[model samples]
Target: MTVPASTAPPQDEVSPDALQAATTPQSPARRRGADTRALTQVLFGQLKELEPGTPEHSRVRAALIEANLPLVRYAAARFRSRNEPMEDVVQVGTIGLI
Candidate 1:
């Protein structure tokens, strides 16, 4: 099922650093909205470009990851905690390793 654009966060709202992940090529049509695929594209594109060694790149990457954290947290919140720790919740949300 397609997610509504309004409920999804805007791609532009995602930080530039997070958008650098290496990714599969995408056409303009794929980049048009805020669905999970679009977000995946944005994240992978950033990860691909992220310069792992430099401090600047490190900071940006951290920031982007940080920014995306809220969304992930929100997703994890959907399932019952079931005595799961908060760290586990975050780890589960971090499945977007795209």
Candidate 2:
């Protein structure tokens, strides 16, 4: 999510007045979903370029899993009333995600 310094707008070039906008704030869940989608797209693109079983491919695959962990947790929360351990639920959900 880090923007490179070279791509940053210069401080003097930014207008404070232009920064004001009337917009509804997005909920954290919505924002996170959007971010996850974008990250997954980028990572998948990278994954396609990498040869399977290479270190880079493995790293990107791991990143994809990590980035989507929130989704697994969210799904796992639905089963909370079932009396199963939360960690176990998440683990099973993660396995499905993988």
Candidate 3:
């Protein structure tokens, strides 16, 4: 799915500090969890406003999947001792996530 051009902020308006801060390591797990929840809520709200089968909707759905990938990885980790490939576990977890 392609992200619509209008969804992106103009490149010239993005400051170096903002980019740096976004890439920097977050605080503790509690703070990160709260941030994730807030982001999810906002994305879902945006998704709700868009029409289904449109690029904007697909972009939001893709964003939701990308945002929660860590959760899939964490769940997949629990099966590490089952003699299965980690990739396989992660793939299955991702499918469940979708």
Better of 1 and 3 by TM-score: 3
lDDT of 2 by residue, 1-98 (tens): 99999999877655555554325577898988999999999999999999999999999999999999999999999999998999999999999999
> Which tens-of-lDDT digit does each residue in 4-75 have in candidate 3?
999977676778899998899777976777877899999999999999999999999999999889888988
Model 1 misses residue 98 by how many Å? Answer: 10
TM-score of each: 0.40, 0.71, 0.65
Once fitted onto the true fold, the runs of candidate 1 whose alpha carbons sit more than 4 angstroms away are 1-50, 81-87, 94-98
* TM-score, predicted candidate 3 vs. hidden true structure: 0.65
Every candidate's lDDT: 0.65, 0.92, 0.91
What CA root-mean-square deviation does each model show from the true structure? 17.8, 10.5, 14.9
Model 2 CA lDDT for position 5: 100
For model 3, the stretches where C-alpha displacement exceeds 4 angstroms are 1-27
Q: Per-residue error at 97 for model 2, in Å?
A: 1.9
- The sequence of per-residue lDDT tens digits that candidate 1 reaches over residues 1-98 is 99998998866466555566545456664444345445656656776787778876666566556656767777778765468887787797786732
State the TM-score for model 1: 0.40
What value does the lDDT take at residue 94 in candidate 2? 97
Better of 2 and 3 by TM-score: 2
